[model samples]
Target: MLKQFCEHCGEETEHKEVIKQKPSKYGKSKKEQFKAFLSGFFGGVASQVGASLDLIDRYVVCKKCGRKKLENLGDEFQ
Candidate 1:
């Protein structure tokens, strides 16, 4: 749970982090098929840079009114 100001609620309320599906997958490699290896090594990772770029959206939804607000924390780190 997170505490944030919700415009719809007009007050500080509990918010939940929600990651919605990306708008599109064009030009991006689809999620690799799961593979299992029993010999010695485990399955191979799909990306060396971890998560895909803009593959999903982050939002903080108000628990009271169920309103969603975009959480743009990526700009801070960049």
Candidate 2:
């Protein structure tokens, strides 16, 4: 399961899981697959947060529409 703030509406949204019709037989087990998905999702989040922090450290701000306003902190780190 994946969740994120919608860039257009700034609302929290759940990304539905996509189930394959034919999962690979040689692939990871169910637990491993779950873990991998979670790890990948969080990895993406971590990278985004890190990039945002890097921007703030340089006293810079993104001009991205709704994301900037939602992510901005007032002289503090999230």
lDDT of 2 at 45: 62
| lDDT by residue (tens digit), candidate 1, 1-28 | 6999998889999999986544453333
Q: Any runs in candidate 1 off by more than 4 Å, and if so which?
A: 27-53
Residue-level lDDT of model 2, residues 1-58, one tens digit each, is 4455555555665543322212323257888677655554565566445532332222
Among the numbered candidates, top TM-score falls to 1
Worst 10 residues of 2 by lDDT: 55-64
In angstroms, give how far residue 39 of model 2 lies from its true place: 0.3
> How accurate locally is residue 73 in candidate 1, as Cα lDDT from 0 to 100?
49
lDDT of 2 at 47: 40
The true-versus-predicted C-alpha distance at residue 56 of model 1, in Å, is 1.9
Error of 2 at 58 (Å): 29
Per-candidate clashes come to 0, 0
User: What TM-score goes with each of the models?
Assistant: 0.59, 0.24
